[model samples]
Target: MSLSVMILEKEGGLAQTEFLEPSRKGYCLSCLDAVKTLQETGRFGEAQNELEDALRESENWREMAVACLLLGELFNKWGAASPSYTIAIMEKGAIYANRAVQLWQIARDEKLFEENPEDMDHLSSALYWKALNLASVAGLGGCERWTVLEALQAATEAAEQMSAMEDKKHSASEVKARRDFVEGIIVFCRAKALEGNHVSPTDFSDCYHQDTKDEVNFLRHQCLELFISAQEILSAGKQTMCDQNIKATTMIAVTYRLLGEREKAISWSEKEVQGRLQLHGEWNPRTQLAKRNLSMLKGITDEDEIEEDCCKLFSFESARSIKSEEITWSLDPFKLSSTWRMNCLLKIFLLTGVVKEFQIEEDKLIKFLQKVRKSYHDENPFHNWYHAWSVTHCAFMLMKETAIGKILGMKEKLAVLIACLTHDLSHPGVNSDFLIKSASPIALQFPFSNVLEQMHWDEARSLFEEGRETNFLSHVQEELRAEILEMVHQGILATDMQIHKQIVNSLSNRRDSLADFEEDDMTLLSDKAMTVYDATSPADRLELFKAVVHCADLSGQVMEAPVAYSFGRAVLEEFHQQAQREKMENLQESAFMKNLHE
Candidate 1:
């Protein structure tokens, strides 16, 4: 036995040796046959119910354990069939597996294993499923209460049993493959934790990275070797080993991508796409996603192409016809594309007199806007450049149509507008919850709260750093510049949905408190409302500005029905993609996200 195996058995208080035989009569034969028939016919839900019913009805400990193990396997199949094998589903599998282990322990206490040595075979299978399910949900940071170390221990126990069995069902090579795959997952999870970029294995987002950090690259190289080894071993096993082999193949491709070996990554990805198509068919979501990945790899292009197009497409002249009448809250960002979006944004700034009042150089302003637009991930369905433009335009509409414009100084207005523009810089197409649960490097650095919001603020700070030419605030007076920067930070942080209700409640409370004034005073204040607003405390003004930007960030639902519907669909598509990744990576799906579909 390996050191890990020996240590696990000792720590778990399990026996060092056991004798077992494959059941010639296969325990609970009739019940299993019915479940298998349902599974084979693709009625996995029905199969799951049947096994669950069997578990409750069985009197004998051995029979109950067998039923529990079958139920665990059926849940696995059910989840995989849905193509959304979430952490919740994996937890259910782990529950059944744990029950099986407990049932077998009862059998061991009653000396049933001695009467029927085949009972040990069922115990070994239960151990294996328990380990695999725990590992799936454990992730790098530990999900619920399951940890990778626990999975490692369970796998070691299972390997010990398989090794000592007199009539093992799995061949020696297949057993080794299983062990290697589990070890590979541990290493892969570590690499993911270190690397910080948590894009899925099949996600080709930002595929042209110059290099990964040395530490992450080293771990990935180790993972690649183990996955390759497991794949080779599983290749010699029965067709039942095909799914495991495909998993290995996917990891190999992902590791190669992380290492910046595009040729190898593409080659392995092609094979994975083919395997997915064969196993799941063309219409299956996983298969469709695989095909999309393959297409992205084959279609990799020069990153400069977008920059060059932006330079050629945008100018002040492009915004000549963009008037207040044409551009309102009803503006559809989906129809505008990059060129018109950039132009419309410039026109809004011009209309608000932000450019002239701040004495911003036109060339510097264009360069700054171009860089800001490039910072957004065009690949993201919702939080991309178009979303940024839409948010900024909504803020502009509020300023023009409401009293918000008269209430703020020029600096505050400019800061809030800039905040809307860069709020989602370099989004990885996933949310803060994902980062925290996956133990991503970003989460480790930010820790506990406002994970994505803090990261976005950091990126925005980099773009607006004092001395850079792209920093449009460079020529502004030092005292005024500091004020704008502080407000920008507050504005960006305000966009975090975590604090949305607090902002709304504060704003509403302040509005309601205005009713306390005498009617005569209120009549006098109505004509000079701007005077009353400007005389309010600076802290109150800042809070009000934060509310404005926060509202603009979520302005989609308040737009015209058709435009709102389009934006809603785009939002759902982005959410579905994140939920899909959560499922594929064995992380917990967001409750609100699940509710959206329901």
Candidate 2:
């Protein structure tokens, strides 16, 4: 998707094109050449000023849309160059592209497309550029998840329209290439949204989540193919398709870097840098960005090295000497570092006989625990690894010391404890309300009800899947694996505070039935689900398990006053931060958060 300035001839210069007035043809050609030169030479401001002036002087909607599209392209390049202004600049580009789309839509509605069939191309191109701009904004973060979905929708619509065009004006190969290019960008944007960060692609410090790593890499490979195909198809039409070719090249470089093909990434990046230098000069922001990317690639190494180094930092000591009493809520998990928290969790797992009974390999279990610990972002004051450790520790205590512990089978108990450990996995610190209000990426992908809980359950399930190196349950009996995972899912979802009352009430309704069971009749709490118990139904048992985990999730409230106060304050501070972001974004702030801030 590019500026509608030229129709390529044999030499790739401007040809007789649609939307040009015969009387003003010479003037238009001369002006377009001058503007293209200004753009290529990196005189973006001058070119933009000129285009704005031209826009104001436009005699028709067609000219206006063209001017807006050009401005959007310029802003995209400008945003690429300036890191700090990327969001704002890309947003501005989206606005301009949207305006162009509107103008074209107006023109088409006025029967312009029917009268001049070639105008449909203009409309499709506007939509394509609009999609690209919005995708760029979404990929940069701060925008709502709806914006990303909208970009994808727009791109799809554009591609459909391009494919339906029967006009010979656009080459068949070029049309297909442009459509592929748009699809590649859509895939790339999806990958970035999945990453849940606005950080540069080169910054591998926080990469994909352990579970989503495969899916993200799959998308990367798919996009890389799309980009490579687009670049190859446009190779012969470089002069006419300069913008799209360079964009494909840029994406190819980025995709390779993300795919961990460092040398190929560097190779593609070097080509992009040289291409930009030749086309736009050394001072061009696009050229500068390419140069920076190339330099970063040369300096940095594989991200796996970071993972390896992290593994070296912590060792799992044998848990034979660790006491069960140390897993109680009286112990402050917040006081320990993430590594110590991991070690503590491992010891508890061992002490509880979960590892031994489940036939969990210690090394694989440690690896899984490390990944889970790392999944919790430390930047979140309330929902960090500390919170996960604390909640898990509380669950461990309940499973060992409480009446509910006595009622659960080993599979159910293990499920409840594991669920608690991972109940807040990959939490972004913001509450469900905030995620819903912002329409954040996770919010969009997940159902609105207990969105974060669903995400946690999904991630937890992924961690224990077959063939995963970190899967502690990989060698477990298929039947046992299914039972534990199902319980884990329910336990995790039950931790959603929104349904807290429902879960408690459900458990309350079963209390009479539960009390009637004798110690000998408590075989339902063990592995014999086939044995009919008089007092408890399977549903009642599940509800009890739900309530148990839910209680563990809220155990921070029952902690000693000082520890409880710290937790409360941490959550409040996190709420305040989310509220501030809402205010900055001009979104509706949470009422409680507003009250807290005031």
Candidate 3:
């Protein structure tokens, strides 16, 4: 299935041999190094040489795709460097940008995004640059209509591309913030074009003749609206960059001036000038430019007034805080039977130094758990939030009793814990068999597969992403989290018994391996590592995680008689209902329905 329905959601430098056996990644990195210096200094000519080399003998389509986009961007950057527009450079930039867009389109047509979704981001970047190249044309001449509209369209497509990156590599806010940035830039271009078109004639310019007073009035209003929208997005996107705000202020000043609002123009220009002067200092070139603009607006002959740039970049000391002191975790979910008992389990997980070992923030973990707890279908007799807590509790007890925490490394333990906690999340109070038999749409996506388990994991993943945005696992490194999550995914899926033979065989091998191994004290590994611990292979650890969670999920069968029977009765009741539902709806009854009376 397309992932849309799914809750979708560096190393620098290179050695020589790394290039000899060049992968797409190696080629891309080499190309990146070539252009990396361009951002600082150096001639565009040198950067083009490296880019051409990468493109000349490219074996990887994705690498070629990246090279084309980067080549386009390189030319664009070069074109934008000159104060006066150079027709040759501008035309070359536009041509490359268009080619980049075409190559990306061809890739999509070839199902490259489907074949390897990571290519989507690169394709998106290619689309955005096309818009950027067109937008830089000042929206003038006979091509103005096409240039302006095409730029807007391409930028919107770029934003769509940004939103498509929900593979857990980025937070939702990070994606939205990026989309907002593109929206801001595209809108700013429109506003800039309009403002420029209506400006008073310069010695060699004829733009004023192109616009009548009424046209100018209408265009200025449109410019103001677009500028405001751009400012709001830029302010909210990632607010640390003070430069965005200054850029917006400059636009506001220019637009107001074109509208014949001299006082308002001067007012906004002064803010920009003052901000630039304070931020960059009086001697800075940017500050000098701002001063000249302000001087023209204010009709001043005197020295410029300097103001303090009180604006600051974002810095959070809490991001680096370490919890060295031990915490006493005392919550016993069995004794404390509140439906909200899951909250305590989460807290205990954190306070017991487990989270410290994982480098996950306590508050984010708590909030994430609470979100899952609240999302449960509590109305269900079984397979509800309380049952979720019970399974997790049983898992916790099993881990403690077996000293599994010691035997299975932290990643395995974590995978087992999280898998147990979220295993049955969002259950519909019906078994997967019934859903499939009834021909439900939910089953259609995973026909003959673990539909319910897949759905539960999908829901859990959605909730997990929400928590991630709030920095729940912000303390955890990305690679480590990905590793743990892989195990967790296996553990959750292992709970499904439809493919019992395969799971049993896999677990038995790992179980025997672990059984002969001597158990030791909990030896914590680095929180940042994604590697396997001790002598165990990653396959063994993942298998162990799945085996342990499977045991926890079925632990209710071995509980006290009363507790075990209660669960048995609940399952039977749900089965009986499903049977009756099948009869009423004229559907095939599942195996559980045959034994409902028993």
lDDT value, residue 303 of candidate 2: 45
TM-scores vs. true structure, each candidate: 0.50, 0.49, 0.45
Q: Which stretches in model 3 have alpha-carbon errors above 4 Å? A: 1-336, 347-352, 437-441, 444-448, 466-471, 510-535
Error of 3 at 307 (Å): 49
Predict model 3's lDDT versus the native: 0.56
Clash total of candidate 1: 0
- Give the per-residue lDDT digits (tens) of candidate 3, residues 1-598: 1111110100011221111123543454456655544333333355456556766777766666666675665555444433223334445555566676677678778776673544555555666566556555434311433454455455556556545645354445444544554555554455455544522323113333444434445545665765555566556665423554666677778777756577888898888888776555676555666776576455323321221121011012221232322111233333554523534465446533567687766545654565566557867766777567768767766565443555577777777777887888778777887776654545533433588877667655544431132235555654576677667777788889775677667644433444333344221222111222332666555655676788778766667766777777777776787777778898777754666676
Between candidates 1 and 3, name the one with more favorable lDDT: 1
Better of 1 and 2 by lDDT: 2
lDDT of 2 by residue, 1-598 (tens): 0122211111122321222332342235333554555534434345446656677777876667766765665566555533433676678777777788788878767776573445665567666777677777767664553355565566566556656666566788888788889888877876776565343343433444444546567778988999999999988665432767777898898788767676888899888887777766787545675786575456422543466766554444635445656566577765766556666777877777777788888777777776677678989989987777778887777666656555666777778778888899999888777776665545534524677887788778766643345678867765578788889988888888888889766644444345455555543334332233222456646767787788878877888887898889888889889888889988788887875756
Off by over 4 Å in 2: 1-317, 512-537
Report lDDT per candidate: 0.66, 0.67, 0.56
Worst 10 residues of 3 by lDDT: 2-11
Would you list the rank order by lDDT, best first? Answer: 2, 1, 3
- Show how many residue pairs clash in every candidate, following the order shown: 0, 1, 1
